[model samples]
Target: MTQWLVLAAAIAVEVFATLGLRASEGFRKKAWIAPVVLGYLASFYGLWLTLRLGMPVGIAYGVWTACGVALVAVIARYVFRDPLTWKMIIGIGLIVAGVLTIELAGVVH
Candidate 1:
């Protein structure tokens, strides 16, 4: 349970760092750098802790990235007025399905 919590936190932090990346304007903005860097640092630390807690690397990465991608897409649409086309929505669905498949496989094994 604690490992899953850490993984969730890592995903959230990674999403924030990605948003910070956009706000950084290709690293041109100074103010966004701190959050971007710190968020990434914290995210990786959380990921490391999750792994140390015995989560499989493949499953951890798959779940982390899939959730991050979906969350970022939704958040970016609202925050940056980024387009969320049907194609992107479909892609997110596929990613989610793939993650679920991987997770279920792990459980079955």
Candidate 2:
């Protein structure tokens, strides 16, 4: 339970850092730099905690990255007016499915 929460926090922070990277405007904006740096630092720390809690590296990373990609895509569509094509949506769906498959495999092992 705690590990899951930590993983979720890590993913959320990574998403925030990714958005902050866009807002940084090629690292020209000073204000956005802080969030970008801090968010990544915190995110990695959370991931470490998740790993220490016994989640396998493959399962943890698969879910972490997949969720982050799907979430950032949706958030970018709204926040940045970025296009979310059907193909991208399908790809995201597949990523989610792959993560679930990994998780199920972990459970059975």
Candidate 3:
């Protein structure tokens, strides 16, 4: 349970960092770099913890990235007024399916 919490916090940090980058304006501004770097570091450490728990790297990374992409897109559409078209939805759906498939495949092994 604590591991899951760590993972969730790490992903949230990543998302915030990504959004911060967008605000950073191509990283030209100095302020956003710190948060971006910290977020990535936290995210990696969280994944490391998951790996320590015997989760395969491929499966863990796949699910983490896929879900991150999906959630980021959702947040962007709602928070940033970015358009969420059907095509975008379809792509997110595909990512979700792929992640789930990878996780399930790992379980069967």
Candidate 4:
């Protein structure tokens, strides 16, 4: 249970870090860099803990990437004023479906 929580936290942190990167504008600004760095550090550490809990690396990674991308897209549209076109929603839906398939498949290979 804690492992799953950690993975969730890691994904959220990673999303924030990615958003911070966009705001950082190539790390020229100080405000954005700090959160980006800390967020990534915390995310990586959380992932490490998840692995220690016997989570398969590939499965954990696939979940992380898919969820992160989807969440980021949604947040971008709402928080960053990005357009939420049908195409974007469809893309995100596909990503979610793919991730669900992978989770259901259960084997990495």
Give the clash count for each candidate: 0, 0, 0, 0
lDDT of 4 by residue, 2-60 (tens): 88899999999999999888778799888998899999999999889899998878668
In the range 23-96, model 2's lDDT, one tens digit per residue, is 78889999999899999999999899999999999998999999899999999999998899999999999999
Model 4, global lDDT? 0.87
Give candidate 3's TM-score. Answer: 0.88
Pull out the clashing pairs in model 4: none
Query: Which residue ranges in model 1 land beyond 4 Å of their true spot?
Result: none
lDDT of 1 at 60: 92
Residue 65 C-alpha lDDT in model 2 = 97
lDDT of 1 at 9: 99
Q: What tens-digit string does per-residue lDDT give for candidate 3 at 1-101?
A: 66667667767888888877777888999899999989888888888897787778877788778878988888888877778899999999998898889
lDDT of 2 at 38: 98
Local distance difference test, per candidate?
Answer: 0.95, 0.94, 0.83, 0.87
lDDT of 2 at 98: 89
| Residue 24 Cα positional deviation in candidate 2, in Å, after optimal superposition | 1.2
Q: Give the winner by lDDT.
A: 1
lDDT of 3: 0.83
* Cα error of candidate 1 at position 12, Å: 0.8
lDDT of 3 at 46: 87
TM-scores for the candidates = 0.97, 0.97, 0.88, 0.88
Stretches off by above 4 angstroms in model 4 are 107-109
